[model samples]
Target chain A: MPQGQPLTVPNDGLTTKARRNAPLLAVHTGPGKGKSTAAFGMALRAWNQGFDIAVFQFVKSAKWKVGEESAFRELGKLHDEHGVGGPVQWHKMGSGWSWTRKQGSEVDHAETARDGWAEISRRIAEERHDFYVLDEFTYPLKWGWISVHEVVEVLGNRGGNQHVVITGRDAPQELIEAADLVTEMTKVKHPMDAGRKGQRGIEW
Target chain B: MPQGQPLTVPNDGLTTKARRNAPLLAVHTGPGKGKSTAAFGMALRAWNQGFDIAVFQFVKSAKWKVGEESAFRELGKLHDEHGVGGPVQWHKMGSGWSWTRKQGSEVDHAETARDGWAEISRRIAEERHDFYVLDEFTYPLKWGWISVHEVVEVLGNRGGNQHVVITGRDAPQELIEAADLVTEMTKVKHPMDAGRKGQRGIEW
Candidate 1:
């Protein structure tokens, strides 16, 4: 037998129908990039294959942004066409960086963060869908909204048959280490940093 | 003003925005139903109006099941056509299901449930998507995989500006009570119970 290859046994205890468990895959990439985009593509691919799927968008509010929200709406349309039923759920943080700037330090971003994490914890324990995607997850840890240890504990103990993908910049080293698969996206070049504003339908 | 209507006094020391937070909606329907489908439609409507959106799919495996996976795979294509970027993301649960027939015990189911919830909790805490959906969340709880209290904690504490949705039959009483909106799908009729299996391009 080749090195590192499993040795076949004619009468081993294992049956021909026995199946092996699948490991988790995590996608972590840098800022101003397509980490979430790539993750979403993978999700659509999995969903079309008849697997049950669930999605949680952390830290974001419903306020209209230019690019991200519009594309999500399109995904929702696709979900509808496919007749996969579930509420496209959201847990929004009341505070935003811009809003906080205008309102001063009185804004309570911490409460928003706390509230968001609580819901997240519950969903993980419940294990409703076969696949989950965590978008922009790194920020909570980066912003000190939640602890890395807590995140690790939860992920380490997750159920079998569940696949997860996480996207963000500045992912914690612990998270990267815990993940079975990690992909980093480097921004080679972009039109935004050159001082040209984002264009509608292209950037937004 | 009507009895239930608020009595205003020159703004009452509060801004109009403060008086009403954005509407947060959640929909959890019955088994083998279309909760995600309805939520997705709402997301599309919100997106077309120029809202910023985000998406996360929970408990998904890499194995393709139907056409939905293909649609998620084409998320980048959708983004390219719509000129939206950054908001759409996806995550998959790398682990597959915990089989009851194989394990042959409730304890195995319970363990799987616990693991599943842990993953869901981790993702919910980390990401920041505007429209969040927990598909088939009630399954583990129903099957005795996890406790209901844990599920409640997450749902109750999520941030504002997120319209959250959850789907499944026999949702806990607390979830319904806490929700701003709730819809229970009573199956008046279903094709599967009538001896017809799910039809592709329609059932999925």
Candidate 2:
């Protein structure tokens, strides 16, 4: 599609400006790379536009220091100190959210994921952030760690101008049906095909 | 692929560490969104790891104030002031590079694209930036504005550890063959499919 131009216009009663400004529920999924990275890129754009941003990583290990985490933390710090951008919150689901602690209990991936979804659902109901990134969230829905039906219902009825993006592989048909936009990152080729491993600042 | 792990190990004489650290030529193409966005996301990671970044926009108009452009400018300024991250240089081809000015001539997109490729080629030869983003570059190759053969040659033979990412749809087969990683952004669904137009922040 050409920049800023839609191929067709629906007669959905909404004006062009209203339809254009409607918040998006986007999903990035497939068996390729860059799904989370692309969502983070959109987060950067949202932050630049003064939109409050929140990211919840559902599947990645909390100990994994993905490069984007540090970069976003730095961006958050920049916003706090210099007021150059909007606020940011990053949370790793099973490790307990950064905002709340599950004190002495041993980590349970499924329970933690459920709790994380609960928190996110609460936030969506309250319109807590302008932009929400459910990073790798598809895994939870796919594995039955969370209810896809409930998640879709929440997202479809999310209030205000809140925009949400979910990223992972094998996104559920229900979620895809509900999303306003969806992109599948198909792997045409990979270094792994040539027996090459991932590297710092690139894969992470 | 799992983090930092390859499915197979090549018997190509190089050590695993050496192969892991080898620079990449990644292509993000196909008929969907977020190709350039994902590349910029990689740029963000690269910058966090102290990689100098140079982004060349080949198809976007110079007048387009992409949110990432302003955000990177702020990041570049932050680097200048506090030494927080790596430096960044954002360039829009046809309007002339930020480092150099072309005076007294009307813009010819094809010639300007060729000039942009020439500049990128020279930079690659000199090992200028640690990370290079040739945004929307495939169009020039597809349209015969710049040569795909020459691009593949320059990228394949580039010296040092410069990682280059090319983004746009309809990537040439030769270029894809030479790339270390290639992701095709397939459009599963889009807001435009329902007649919704692109919005600011998300589209730009």
Candidate 3:
């Protein structure tokens, strides 16, 4: 905390009494790995706090299974069995969505991405979950499939204590400006640079 | 991956045939949030691979309980009950370390930090764990408590398939150059900029 300049408080001074608890719009975008993973970590924390958590992975192939997906799914089941926490729901582009159909073309992919965004807009309107993680969501926006302006507007006006996190590289300027918390994962070096392939469990 | 120049492969190409599967030295350092959180997520991935996981938290107060601590502890316990995964050990500066004796002075704090480094050096040499997460480790190095040269040397020579992750802001240049993977968390926005304080689950 003391290494660099201490973060500036918005007002001259912000005491606990003056602290307002508001929903956060967090964006994790960068070339370095783990942008989605960090968002998942936040989701895990939110779930521990009993927040209803929803995950929408925009790009990961249905065949790919991330460790977080299974962990959260198990936690979701625990909610039903033990009634210890809130509900957990996860939807991936491949399985839960058929917007692009089984055989996908560029147009179909774009169409599916838009449908996905529309559904997210609805969820935001309904305040369906306390925490929403849009994994690899930046692609659709960056690809021009979903309008960045529209996404920003919906997120900016979302109601209640809904915390939304979007992850992927090259986040739009509008979305970055709109977010309350944005972290860009800048890559310094990687094993991949050493002509190495990502390992199972480590990379996926 | 395609937005910027695609990352350069160390050589012509790295296929599974030539994949070394060597241990990784990864550093996560920056002003933005989630450096350590991303490391924790990587730890979670390693744990799923059944690698024995050890977390050494350098700066977080003993009283400040991060959600990952509880989650990993439970996962460790499950290793004994159901034999599901690897053992997990977490050591924070406050309790496990007494180099500063409880009451901390500038000089005393520096001594404690160095002691922490010494212990980590031993662990690296001993190959104590498959995965090592040095949370907020860059602080001691940045503060000049530990010799960066010694650290780089020890880590460079560590044996076995031991992976190490270091997280903190303002990491030394030498460390970045030494690491196999280095990520700098760049800040784009924050809740504090809007006069909002961190929330319980989100911040921790």
Candidate 4:
């Protein structure tokens, strides 16, 4: 009924649009917790929403010691059956801790880290999938095997449409500030803290 | 001094273990040339001998575009400094690509490549590099991001010697074949086939 007043647009549609284009979330916190587990849950939810997903386990090897690798292997089968636009790709850093145990600082761990990052970067750049998970990535950077600036650049410049979730411990403050959502997975308690050691299935 | 069958074994100066370790050589090659130029002549060779070396570059970003963004803008003055690791680090993957007037497949660009290969499996498992180069790593695996088997398990199992080199067009093969040394650069004449472009101090 106010003739001279400017018309107000509805806020609901704008909020929906903003949620659709939300920047990626970064989950990090103290060690010995369930950050990856929460991320995997989100991945499942995204997959259910018909989004293409790719998971890159940065520091893991392909030996399939844990059940997650087997589940991922099965996901590959499901992806093939569904004929998804982008397949679920898993990249592992091949070098285990044994060599590091022997050589100490002699090895160029940085290059190895760079190599792993390259694979993840390519997938993101190519838009191979809608959602990507870089698991256990922060540890290598913290250990000084990768340049933080380079990592920051890649994350900062990622295509706006793509969604990414990075899970690790002690995420740098810069990453926290850059993230659209940051979840800290603090460990209130764990069986490992009781000295029972990590068990199969649940711990993994 | 000449008796039936006996010459005393001499410990004097005939040690079989006196050979020096061979330098690691990695070549980056693809539909686009200059992989080697980016790796060795530009970056790896410039670092001091004592410093560790790791090289990896494939299809470069638009940052290399003359007016848009130069290597100087992307990498800063690190190239001129000697204590810095190497030139190839700049090649790692700059702020990624800016979409131009041309409508292209975002699915096939160089932006996310560094993430995929940054923490290469072999590097994580072995942690073996005074120097390492992953050159021209985009081609073969362009369609199918390389399997966890090739990158993590096989390549990650190499010796902990001082250097490691990985160069080729589309790095997908069994990759299980052990390499004390490996080089994969395709041979062909380029547009500098026709003299339209020449090597610049930074890109070449």
Best candidate per TM-score, number? 2
Cα lDDT tens digits for candidate 4, A67-138: 444434443545576543234555455562322242324446566666667767776778677777777778
lDDT per residue, candidate 4, B1-204, as tens digits?
Answer: 001121233343533222123223233323322233323322222232223444444444433323112221212223234223233232343333222222235444433453536454445456634555554464525555555355535454555543444544554444413332222222222222222222121112
**Candidate 1 vs candidate 4: which has greater TM-score?**
1
Q: Identify the runs in model 1 with alpha carbons over 4 angstroms from their true place.
A: A1-25, A60-91, A94-107, B1-69, B72-204
lDDT of 1 by residue, A92-179 (tens): 3435332223221454766555555666666678875666777677887888888878987887787756667776778888887777
lDDT of 2 by residue, A59-98 (tens): 5465443688888888888899999778999888645666
* Residue lDDT tens for model 3, B1-118: 3221235545556555446466788998889888877887887777777789988888746644467777677667656666765789987776446433554443466766777888
- Of 1 and 2, the candidate ahead on DockQ is 2
The number of residue pairs in model 1 that clash at the backbone is: 91
Write the candidate numbers in order of decreasing TM-score. Answer: 2, 3, 1, 4
Q: Could you say which candidate leads in lDDT?
A: 2
Q: Candidate 2, residues B1-204: lDDT per residue as tens digits?
A: 356667788889999888988999999999987898899899998888888999998854654537888888888887888897789998887466555666315657787888889999999999999999999899989999888998998898998889999999999999999999999999999898788887876776
Better of 2 and 4 by TM-score: 2
| Residue A71 C-alpha lDDT in model 1 | 45
Interface RMSD measured for model 3: 3.7
Docking model 1 quality class: incorrect
lDDT value for model 1: 0.49
Better of 2 and 4 by lDDT: 2
Q: Which portions of model 3 miss their true places by more than 4 Å?
A: A1-19, A63-65, A83-86, A95-107, B1-20, B63-65, B98-107
- Single out the weakest 10-residue window by summed lDDT for candidate 4 chain B: B67-76
